[model samples]
Target: MPEETPLHERILDTTEQVLRRYGPEKTNVVDVARALGMSHGNIYRHFPNKKALLDAVSARWMHCFTESLSTIASDSKVAPAIRLRRWFDTLRETKRKKIQDDPEFFQMYHTIAKELHDVVTAHVAELLQQLETIIRDGIKAGDFHAKPGASSAAMAFLQTTFAFHHPALLVTRVPSDDEADTVFDLLLSGMIAGPVSKKLRPKVKKS
Candidate 1:
């Protein structure tokens, strides 16, 4: 026999449908309850109120991105450099797809994220920690050097590539994929643990 769906799961599913149809600003417990064919109090039993429900929805959305990145981070088969590159590319693609696929929902969550400061902060810290783990592994493998702290390097890499990851650039002045790869290589080449090629080598003036 098929297992019954949890009430919270049902509530979340119905809430998403309501949110997508009417937007988070206009969505309410009554609407979600009506969609689920239940009383609004039923939703409250699972969630304190609308904000808590919305936060749970936003968190569920954030995890979809993190879960993929976590797999890349924990995979020992791939080289750190490759993992790093894939992580950056995947993040860019995820944001781009979200904006392109359901622009209204994306905008609604974008606004919600700003209000969900703790959730957003925790999510960013986790992403940065994953990046730091990759960088730390690279340093241990002699693939990277931590002249300036590996943690700092990871932070720098994330910030340098912020344009591709930040929601602010989700719809505006985004760089082409080629441009992003070029920038990644340029920054990454400096961090790698070996001699730079003449082409990548910075010029030094003879005194």
Candidate 2:
């Protein structure tokens, strides 16, 4: 006989399906319990309320992308600049694929994300931490010149590329590879440690 799935997993699985089918507004613990052939009280045992259940589902979805980014961030064999580019590309592609493959779930998740600000904030925090790791590695390797700190640099990187991976913007338009590359190259130029090109350098004042 196969091992039974844990009650917590079962509840989460059922809740995800419920949310996908009916969206966050319509999904509830009772619906999950009904689908799982258990009492609503049992669902409550695992998740305190509907908001908690939705947050778990949202977190799980976000984890799919975070795990992949973490791998690229920690890959020391790859140069930090290349890894940073790869990280950004992977994130943009993952979000686009999720939207293309399961639009309903994507829409549902976006709704939950808007309502549960903390969950989205936490997810962004994790992404920033991963980004900081990559930036710090670059600074150590003498490939990057972040003035203040890796943490601030990481925030700037995310903010600059917000349109590519942010759900709100992604739903509106998935930027082309060329566009993303142009933006990334411009951003990378600033962080890269080297003499600034005369054209890009600020004009000095003449006395």
Candidate 3:
């Protein structure tokens, strides 16, 4: 016989289905319990409230989304520049695919994200840490120049590419792959260190 799924996992799985059907606003513990054939009190035992349940679901989704990128970020075998570019490309494509394949889940995620600021904030922080790792490696390899620190450079990279991966912007319009590549190239050019043509160098104003 196959091992049974844990009650906690079942609750989260059922809660995701409920959110997909009714969205975050209408979803509640009772809905999840009804779907799972359990009492709402049982759900409270696993998750304190609806917000906590939503947070867990959102965190799980984010973990799935970030897992691949994490692998790319830590891949020392590849050049940092190449890995960085691949990271952003993967991030953009993942978000696009998620939206295309399951729009209801995507919209539900957006609604939950708005209500659960802490969960969103934690997710962003995790992404930044991954980016920072890649950037610090790049600096060590002399592929990039970040004078301040890897953390700040990582922030810059994320903020610059927000249009491609951010849920709100993606919901409004998904940029073409070519457009995302162009932006990544532009951002990379600024960070990469080495001999550069005069035109590519930033001109400084005389004091």
* The candidate that achieves the highest lDDT relative to the unseen native structure: 2
- Candidate 2: give the clashing pairs: none
Alpha-carbon deviation at 137 in model 3, angstroms? 0.6
Tens digits of per-residue lDDT for model 2, 65-159: 89999999999899999999999999998999999998767877887799888889999999999899999999999999986779999999999
Each candidate's root-mean-square deviation in Å? 5.6, 4.7, 4.3
Q: What tens digits encode model 3's per-residue C-alpha lDDT throughout 30-103?
A: 99999988889888878888888888888888887799999999999999989998899899889999999987
C-alpha lDDT of residue 90 in model 1: 90
lDDT, model 1: 0.83
**Against the correct fold, how does model 2 do in TM-score?**
0.89
Total clashes in model 1, counting residue pairs 3 or more apart in sequence or in different chains: 0
Q: Identify the runs in model 2 with alpha carbons over 4 angstroms from their true place.
A: 1-5, 193-207
Q: CA shift at 89, candidate 1, in angstroms?
A: 1.0
* lDDT of candidates 1 onward, in order: 0.83, 0.87, 0.86
Which candidate order results from sorting by lDDT in descending order? 2, 3, 1
- Candidate 3 yields a Cα-based lDDT of 0.86
